[model samples]
Target: MSTTTTEVLAFPNIKAIINDNGTAEVVVAGNSRVVPVGETLQDLRDNALALVVAEAKTLQRPVRVRIEDPEGHGELIVHPDGKVESVSYETRPARHRTAAPASTPAAAAVEASDSAAEDVAPADDEAAQQAVAADAPVTRRSLKETSFLVSAPVLEPATQGWRGALTRLGFRMNPSAEELSEREDIRTVSQHWPGPRTIAVVNRKGGANKTPTVVMLSAILARYSGAATVAWDNNESQGTLGWRTEKGAHDRSVLDLIDSSTELLSPSTNAAEIAKFVHHQTADKFDVLRSDENEEGDHEVTAEEVDIAHQVLTRYYRLVIMDSGNTARAANWRRMIDHTNQLVVPVTAIEDRAEAARLTLQTLESRGGHDAELARNAVVIVSESTDAKRSMTGDALKRAKAEAQRIADGFEPFVRSVVRIPYDPALVNGPIRYEALQPATQRAWLAAAAAVAKGF
Candidate 1:
């Protein structure tokens, strides 16, 4: 024979409960519903409580409830198992307020009528409190039809009236990354501002995984330093930073400002105007200077234009990560390298790409023409794949050691540490937002960022 059980739960109002798996269902008052499979009686009760809290939070008010099941107060139960017997709920004080003060006779009459109504409201409030105290096993009876009222306390309009409630919901607040970045912009733009540091995550060979490294490093800097960092799509012909970030094509780009001729030239040339050219890629944190895929004009920016852009950028940013192209080096590349305090050359450990890394090291060593000092500051990174078929030990490592030795032979004392960055796909997609990243992935990115920041 089948069994049927009854339980009563007092909820101030009905709301849909969102389960752990993100599925939602509504539990209504005066209804007898069987708990679904995999959902315990306690689970259902906890869901009801969570739903109540959520509703209270949303309405910004206290909620009222009346029990309709089990025919009695203590007859209601949650965890029927001896492991845990029952659960209880009590209504909190309902918020109330008096009618506003009046000057006119009609208004006065209204206030007087409201004052009389307040006399009866206290009884209702007391009755609600008594209902809250009825958790003990006792007969439950239907009273004169009472309502589960969700009420917002009336407030005086003079002060920052509505703002108080909105503040509780964190209204008009930019996210943490964006808020901190704005402060960085202020500090960077202040008087006595020095030149900003621009580090180009470069590899001349295509498909070298350069873009992902730039994106990850930029995000890491934004999180750790709590500063606004700009990622420039300086890849000449085509770019992917904006596309990958999903910032849309209409986003204002640096190319829109300094294409070929007519550089904004000087620091006095409207800093605000220069700032207007930078698009906040998302809210405010990581800004971007994107690329126009079909920018047809043959107009090419001179070294002077690059210089002006850097000057304006420095005024409003502490760090700029440039994603440069593998094609012919733009005049901006030399100027950028000259201005940057550090140079990051990201390369994979593919046997086929080993010679390309060698040539890049040689190119860095050849800074005698434009600036020798810039070459001295460069850091080489050999990005090892976490899933690389070859081992990090034995002959695979022997080959890696050989590549390191080859670069060391050419650059000698200039080559800094050649750190190995394990391949992380999250770095390729977007910022390591909490919900978007695994705990392990976030830790790996942070560790890599710290390693690089410390000149490893």
Candidate 2:
């Protein structure tokens, strides 16, 4: 007498296409459904696994799945009992392409297999291999050609808000949605681009918060990304960025940097030598290239000087945030716009400031070419009035909020993004430090910086 081996039957294979926009298109037995999966490659993988496992349990059989994402392609075997076995996984050299949708032949084969599963006998190993070969695309790599190097699942422990409180009290909990969003914002600002980028902060009116916007963006980006960043006062004359930030060892200004641009730009020049002209913020982790502050001097920075200074700064720093003068028509201001990869207009929530910001963008749009493009993609930051007081009556506060909302709404259609910053006493006076900002204000700036980075 001979003993026979029992074969295990599996349901039709499932296909999952993971998209970069935080959603997955899951194909099951020729039917397609789009599911809102969480952001990140790991999220797509886990959610797809759960969906396939649920289908396997419904059929009371194992199921095979093929997953393609921006990262790479992989295959898995899911058992009805919630066990998952990785068959093959390979990561691409670079995350360049998203997975394409399931093809017609593959869908038809999947549908046929699903309909025949109940009536057909359990398939042997050889037959199962043949079925997979017929359903999978010919371009897919064979099992022997793929690697089985599996990455361990990463679980982020809650470290913020109520979820964090539960975690600290000996309970395991996932991060809240708010915390997850904050994490994504942090990730966005922390990324390093391929090359140096320039951002111009302009409003063409005095006291429009251009200086504050430049300082805050530079500080947030530098503090998060840990990259070299410089805030250059691109004013025609006597800009106040130096008065608002920490002082370095020397009293050097942009004039001094321009005088030595040739020496600094020399291939043999050391990177640290250029630091003599920039003032480092002790708390903000960024440098400030101050403008000429001489009370007796009447000299204005010219367009040619702006080019030379920009060249030197770009050579030394990965990011440059330029604070413009009140005159949008000035040669230096026009040149700064020419060099800007991202345009930011910061307006305090006042009628004149908002109007000035609008006019400034209109001026750029009128110039056409790259100026027009920059104006179209500019990020407008609307800040609440610094005069807002906690002691004010409820109606006064209500009017202030309504005005800010109105100003923000005005630019919503014309620009790429409009961010509102709350009134903070820390930003009103003295040297602006990232640590001095309120928690809410800091979060808002982080969001603003992420918006700026997306333009890069």
Which regions of candidate 1 fall more than 4 Å away from where they truly are? 1-195, 259-276, 281-284, 295-301, 369-371, 386-414, 428-441, 451-456
Q: Write the per-residue lDDT of candidate 2 for residues 1-456, one digit (tens) a residue.
A: 211112334346489888665667779978986544555778777777767766776676677778898778887777765687767789978743334444655565555555555455676545754675576655553587434453334548899988899999999886755676688899999999998999999997898898889999999999999989999999898898999999989999999999998899999999999779999988888999999988886999999999999999999999999998999879999999889999999999999999999999999999899999999999999998876565666899888878999999999999999999988988888888888899999999999999999999
Off by over 4 Å in 2: 1-46, 49-155, 388-391
Residues 337-420 of candidate 1 have per-residue lDDT tens digits of 666666677666664455565566567666574344444556566554434434466788666656545543444355554545
- The TM-score values for the models, in the order shown, are 0.46, 0.73
Say which candidate scores most in lDDT. 2
Give the Cα-based TM-score of candidate 1 against the true structure: 0.46
Number of clashing residue pairs, candidate 1: 2
